[model samples]
Target: MTDYVAKALEVDIDDAVRRVREISEQEAMNQAISVVGAGPAPGGAEWEAEQGTDTPAARQTAWQLVRLRIELATGIDPFGTVLGLRRMGTTWATIAAAAGVSRQAAHDRWGKQVLGVLDAYGTGELGGPVADDEADLRRGMAR
Candidate 1:
């Protein structure tokens, strides 16, 4: 929502949403500055995405810190789908053909995880626990 607005308007995300929604002009400006640091990323490259709001200082958000965290926290499990396909007797070559990747590349990306997941869950279902990467992210965010 906010992301789409930010990209569409070519303005800071806070300005695209929070700034326009504020009751007072000063509050909006302050909030915008606090996150965006007067100027940087389309929406405050310094913003502490983990915090979401009310960050004490700006930090480099390059390397896609916010997008990476958000994606890890919330999204479909392509790996899980791949695992299911493999369990269903789908060949790496077939999966790779659909995914537009080489067989070895697909295997290299998901083979280890798929092999461990069936045993780890002891289930052949489509979905179960979050992936290891998401689990690690949740653990980090817990602190």
Candidate 2:
């Protein structure tokens, strides 16, 4: 396929995936809101009748869902960005500087795993092996 066509297809797929994520996150937020909005805590008689067994689980799940929604909504995929930067030859020291951590600390914390992901993604554009133009694009984006 032509490069333009391939790029368009990739963009379409990315958009579809993003939409699915948004919908799932919205549903999760709605569920969490419902759980939190449920009326006041049960009194002795009501508590005995209703059984508190599900309350803790529900609240925990709801909160967890809410956290996930926040993460997704924030557009902060540390893993992806870190791996991408590493693949683009951003040294650990540079990354650490940007992140406000020591170089050794950055390597110790993320070097192996992030590099591994970067290797898997092949340091490229369109989520494939890195190419010269892709590197140029990354540099452009950085600027």
Candidate 3:
């Protein structure tokens, strides 16, 4: 990808990470508070006696949330990759091929957004990860 596309990706990824962390922290706090407020189950003194506490359940829920956060963070990358392909002069057809969609579908989905970034790139406005040239971007993509 060109510097513009790389920079845009970096910003987007950073924002995604930040949003995930913030939401996860808030969710964790809510879960913790709810767990603390939860008393022994109704008419289950025997079960409570055996289980002791519900900390394990709360911890398990927290672990699930953590995994969800990771998945959301990683899932954002393909958007960047698609934008980068456009910046590198890849045809809409090729992008659509990689995306398992039709050329018109690709354009209908991402053309305007990609065009905006490309315009910014040409104007040297959306400064970002610097690449020497298209060849550098190709190599980076290969890896």
Candidate 4:
């Protein structure tokens, strides 16, 4: 992708993450509504019962949604460090140090590949617009 496109993707990802967070917050509000509608309780029992059932499911769903948001925002598949490095730019070196690898090694492994694929896919030079470039890359690499 061009730098502009990459930057745009970053913006889009940020928006998507914000939207997901909003949805999660809404979900929490929905749970609260349910609890409120369920009526007054005698000594925390009803609240505890609701908590036992709703909290776990809500928490799990929220976490999963956040994970998806992270994936979309970063454009990096799980275990692929490229998106993080690209997003960090010069700070990638510091990230590398924290990850216990030399900066160059980290860059070599993760830096250009995602952007290269983005460029290829964005320009329609690699077949066509991909539904998901990361998934396409993974499939292409597997073949």
Candidate 5:
């Protein structure tokens, strides 16, 4: 679970718990992304037909797979950041600021939900290609 983000933000598991529970500004990020406006858009835009006649429906189908891939892969990012920040000692107030809501609202959206993901990660329940060191994924993010 240790990564650049975790290291730089000091969001290892212990820190996540501490940061998430308190409102202290020891080292929290000033802004946070709201779940409502923060999600990645489902994409099927660049899919090229690999077989058959490249019809609109065929194109649609090709892109459907892309959308599915994106959804399955990066769905954890928003909360992962929250979990990391929270674990790192970032305050809920900081998180809520980014979410544009009260601290409780951010907690309600991501608190318990993050726990489930944290559990999965803690037990290695989920496995796949996790980004290791590359940065700047704005190209893939929602517009």
Candidate 6:
């Protein structure tokens, strides 16, 4: 997509991704609880009412689902980090180094999104001021 279009939709994309991740996380937790009753709380919190059939296979399936959810959620932060780094003028090489990938790989993965963020900033379409701490991170990455 053109940088302008990407920029225009950047916020919407972020919001949509976040919403989906949130839903996935909640669904994973719910499925896990359904399988194993929250697996015995440690802080004296009672488990919620059970929902799914409590069989060994069902429990295993729920566990797998929760694991997959965790993996998917974990993968999203790198996308954000890539955008943040690109926003800060960090070179693709540096970002790739941190990610343990070739520069082309990094760009292939996140370059468009990063470009969108840059476009947003240029057009004054970014929704809010970046946090101070994030700026510090940018500085650190610069060096």
- Evaluate all candidate structures by whole-model CA lDDT and list the values in order: 0.48, 0.53, 0.53, 0.47, 0.43, 0.53
Task: Give each prediction's root-mean-square deviation over alpha carbons.
Answer: 20.0, 17.4, 18.9, 18.3, 19.7, 14.7
Clashing pairs in 1: none
Q: Write the per-residue lDDT of candidate 2 for residues 40-97, one digit (tens) a residue.
A: 4667665565564776444544454344334345653444445555554455555566
lDDT of candidate 6 at residue 127, scale 0 to 100: 41
For residue 54, what is the lDDT in candidate 6?
54
With a 3 Å backbone cut-off (N, CA, C), the pairs that clash in candidate 4 are 1-119
Model 5 ranges with Cα > 4 A deviation: 1-77, 117-143
Q: For residues 1-143, what per-residue lDDT tens digits would candidate 4 score against the true structure?
A: 36997777666477787787667555544553454343436367765676646554444334433443354354434223334333323244543553456655654566456457546455734333322324443454567
Error of 6 at 108 (Å): 1.1
lDDT tens digits, residues 28-139, model 3?
4455446445444656865466475766454443443333333234453344445655554456665666556776676667765765776665674434432223443345
Clashing pairs in 3: 7-128
lDDT of 5 by residue, 14-65 (tens): 7666665343222121211221122223353433332334454333333332
**How high is each candidate's TM-score?**
0.32, 0.32, 0.34, 0.26, 0.29, 0.34
Residue 64 alpha-carbon offset, candidate 6, angstroms: 30
* Candidate 5 lDDT: 0.43
Better candidate number, 1 or 3, judged by TM-score: 3
Query: For model 2, how many clashes?
Result: 3
- Candidate 5's displacement at residue 78, Å, is 1.2
Candidate 2 Cα RMSD (Å)? 17.4
Q: Can you rank all candidates by TM-score, best first?
A: 3, 6, 2, 1, 5, 4
